[model samples]
Target: MTPPTLMSMMIAGGLIGLGLALLVIWFTPAQPDLNDAVKRLSNTSPHRPDAEASTVNGKERLGIWAMRTLPVGLWAKTPTRELALLRIPLARFYGDKLTYAALGFVIPIGLATFLSLLGLGLPFAMPVIACIALAVVMFFLPNYNAIDDAKKARIEFNRALGAYIDLVALERTNGSGVRQAMETAAGIGDSWVFNRLAEELNRSRWSGLPPWDALHALATELGLPDLDDFADIMRLSGEEGTATYATLRARSAAMRTAMLNDELTEANAIGERMSIPGSLLGVIFMAILLTPSLLRMIPG
Candidate 1:
């Protein structure tokens, strides 16, 4: 009797919860000021142009809590999402985006389940499943975009660095001391890399550190081995005001060649990777076409 009574209470509580959820989902009034708030935030945060400032759940708060408590949430949320996202590793790779997605999906699913149980005239199971599927897609999409953006940024920076080096090397070959050449080249640079180099040089000049040393520090900070190597050579060349026009020219050429080779190698590698998927798709299509014939060969 006690066990039966407890079960009855649990069912009753679930029913009540579901009813309230449906009411919120179907009849909850939209916030009148939400559009204005979204417009204001969109104007301010270029990073979040399409981002809503306030949902029923604030995105910022959701992101902060989710990222900080991801490990805990991973352990707690045991659903289709756990299975799908685990397979994709989207949560581990893109915690912030995946968390927002999970939040969005879970809110809808919770509401749908509640409405269904509350006898709301809506298809609960289908809507809940669709929400989960949408969440899975959203979780991975941002990671893909972020990875692409990072790759493009690195490529652009590398190109800028190469041009800056060529300019410095040219000035070095024109009889300027290594320090003087670097300053001249930086001044003449028509790009952002040169601008940054100039800024670092200025700091070094004011702080009484050698310009080459400043370049080395900047290289270390930027993880730029090419710039670091150039700085080392310039440091050595500066000791006796040695002219390294030939060496600088050769290195500049080599760096450009290496950059070209690297780009070609990456392109070829991507092509090879794409071929594997295309081949798999071809095999799958062939199998589908031959399925009837293969079935006919088997004794049913």
Candidate 2:
């Protein structure tokens, strides 16, 4: 066969072998339920019973030795419940209940020994160490993904908040009070941002708290100063009569401008940080370019 064909066949064969190995693990009677094991690993036990699995000392001693030789501790250390809730399918693609952190510890050592036995000219130890290091990084990747999702959600919510404020102000100008404007605006807006506000307002009304107070509470939880300011203005308007719509519109514009400025400043800071690496690379490149000339000019 051609070189490309041969390489494809080799890759296919390796994948088939891995599939068989996984199948064997799946069929093994003693192997714990992959889902259950992953759950135990993630440690999201809302209601774990006091009972622990009892180990028999007689014939099970051999099994205990076998399990200990494997990276069971690393596997056990994974909080399975959290990973299950996270629902990152990428983690399951490698092996369910198998952590990347556990992979380096398990795979590289096993691989190096197998390769050494086959007399392959491979750096066994390095491959093993590299696998382990990679796994360690993969373990925490879900946290970063969650943070990115939250940031996107927050930005969308903020964008929608400005429009919602304008709609409420328009209703107020039509002779509706603060609460009435909020209720009317919320009823008309079908967006998720509005839905969230409506739900909070509904809850506030049911709980005997003012809708403005609920808005302020949500703002505090979300760390949105603009929403908090709107809530404060509304609370004041209830006592001081309907004259704060202009102030609300002005605040909304100012908040939007402030958010834009913050984004620009952050972009500039990131640009500066990026430059440091480029400057270092430039210095290294110039030094390399001048190396021969400097050597020749130096002594003789």
Question: Cα-based RMSD of the predictions, in order?
Answer: 11.8, 11.8
How many residue pairs clash in all the candidates, one count each? 1, 12
Q: Which stretches of candidate 2 lie over 4 Å from their true place?
A: 1-136, 187-191, 206-208, 239-242, 273-289
TM-score of each: 0.53, 0.55
- Tell me how far the alpha carbon of residue 5 in candidate 2 is from the true structure, in angstroms, after superposition: 32
Worst 10 residues of 2 by lDDT: 43-52
What's the distance in Å from true for residue 119, model 2? Answer: 3.9
Q: Report the lDDT tens digits of candidate 2 across residue range 69-144.
A: 5565643344333332233222242242233444444565456546555656354346546666866776555445
Candidate 1 per-residue lDDT, tens place, 85-155, comes to 12222223344565556555666656665664565635435655767787776766655655555456556
Predicted structure 1: lDDT: 0.60
